[model samples]
Target: MTFRPVKATSEGQFTIEGAGVNLYRAFGFHKPREFDPFLLFDDFRNDDPKKFEKGFPWHPHRGIETITYVLDGEVEHGDSLGNKGVLGKGSVQWMTAGSGIMHQEMPRGNAAGQMHGFQLWANLPSSLKMTAPRYQDIQGSDIPEIIDDDGTKVKIVTGSFWGKRGPVDGIAADPLYLDVSVPPNTRKVLPVDTYANTFAYIFAGSASFRDASTPYGVRVEKEVNGEEVNIRDMSGNRTLVNFDTGNEIVVNSGPDGVRFLLISGQPIKEPVAWHGPIVMNTREELMQAFNELNNGTFIKDQRDH
Candidate 1:
């Protein structure tokens, strides 16, 4: 019954990628070891179509898996392996870029000209880095959603929770991806694997997560006599919360409630040699991958065994 304490909190930085898609990079590229088994997380929610319509052009990826979850728009994607599909609102597409593959993702805003979604990169172990590429496209209808009496809602995108299993499986990381929403001023505690590297990305409202817990009650406390509360303890939209090892997480939502993505996975704990979209165990292997691309043999099936 130990509750995980928040180790750190950070806000996303605005970055433009692909041909010209504006996004907020929550975490990636700098400290790989801190977020073991997970490499990058990007939020590409925008109201202006011009900022995101160009989308991510054809790109090559290997030694990792990309999970794209769309909430308010549609994303049309195609790969070099001839796999193609559309990820509409509430849809998810998990692509394993084992060995190598080239893909393109083009986004279109919804009727209100609003596009919202997230992309997460999960690292593959060395043994499965060269495995065959695959795809698991899950529609919103297939995902399991649970509603509690207190108005708390949880959508299990992957992994098991509340005696229900997710539709997508066979992933190397075996991560739990949950979209959780808590009623305003409510306090909730959720279980997590003790050993897994867990984090939460707040995208809707503010909340507080701390090691201090009162056995009596968990409620949103207001400042008395106009005394301001510490801002460091509060996490708002686009804020990332990294937690220490524990079996559960406790959160107290603000006056407006909170919604966030809670994700956790077993750590691979291997050395990472990363360069752009290509990630390998060693620098030599990374160079070889680039060389293969230059030689027109980057795709595994096209390369000579």
Candidate 2:
């Protein structure tokens, strides 16, 4: 089994969104081709309520799907479709803004005034861009969590893993979203689909995703008697690792262990015409979407054929 190599790595950047929510953006806007079938990923995890209470006010989104996963607080959301709900700790909400939708998300911290979560925007192919909008809210209890014999824990948010399937299905991209935690000083190798684009976002602790021959912090490798030596440097918090084409991934956890989100999906391989929250196939289509929003015709009923 071939292991995927690290193509690039980043700690992302800090940004404020909505009315005034402080968050870290791992990737978005600048390069669409680099992460196909996925547009934006924001880590809105905060300890201070002041930085996240305002939350994401009413906004418009089209031609994309937004996946919000909460780990330590509550997120109350409402959309133009009259769908309203609250996402609690370990809960997930996947919303599909097929044609158009005005949405709002307000965060309420836990008892300790800690709010932590992530929001990922997935692009919809041109064929399904105008389809009816939908929502799949899965509670933390409903999602499957697997514990290995060696203390490795994995939460299957979407797609199948280790002979178990997640609760949410019928997604256009057929993505795999996993929350993984590896034991300290352990070496783990996970299998992945060779055809899918894969990446991992480390949120806690440190780990080495590259081979022992070429550890973290160093880009090049040196041959030590033509043998691969175990010299791994750990990648700490907020590290984003993008992998090259392969069917598996190798990870070596540090002393404190490591927790991260391992995500992958099939590439759409289409031209992206993006403008803020709206994404389309062509510039003309993008313009028309804004034009419709201005004329009060953006949101459509599911009955539209």
Task: Report, for every candidate in turn, its global Cα lDDT versus the true structure.
Answer: 0.91, 0.91
Off by over 4 Å in 1: 211-232, 302-305
**lDDT (10s digit) by residue, model 2, range 1-305:** 78798899899699999999999999999788788888889999888999999998999999999999999999999989888999999999999899999999999999999999999999999999998989999999999999999899999999999999999888899999999999998878888899799999999999988665554424435569887555446687988999999998988888899999999999999999999999999999999999999999999877322
Per-residue lDDT for 1-305 in model 1, tens only?
A: 89898899999999999989999999999899899999999999999999999999999999999999999999999999888899999999999999999999999999999999999999999998898899999999999999988999999999999888788899999999999999887778889999999999999987887544542124445677897543334679999999999999988887789999999999999999999998899999899999999999889874312
lDDT score, candidate 1:
0.91
Q: What TM-score fits each model?
A: 0.94, 0.93
lDDT of 2 at 278: 97
Report how far residue 118 has shifted in candidate 1, in Å.
0.2
TM-score of 2: 0.93
Error of 1 at 54 (Å): 0.6
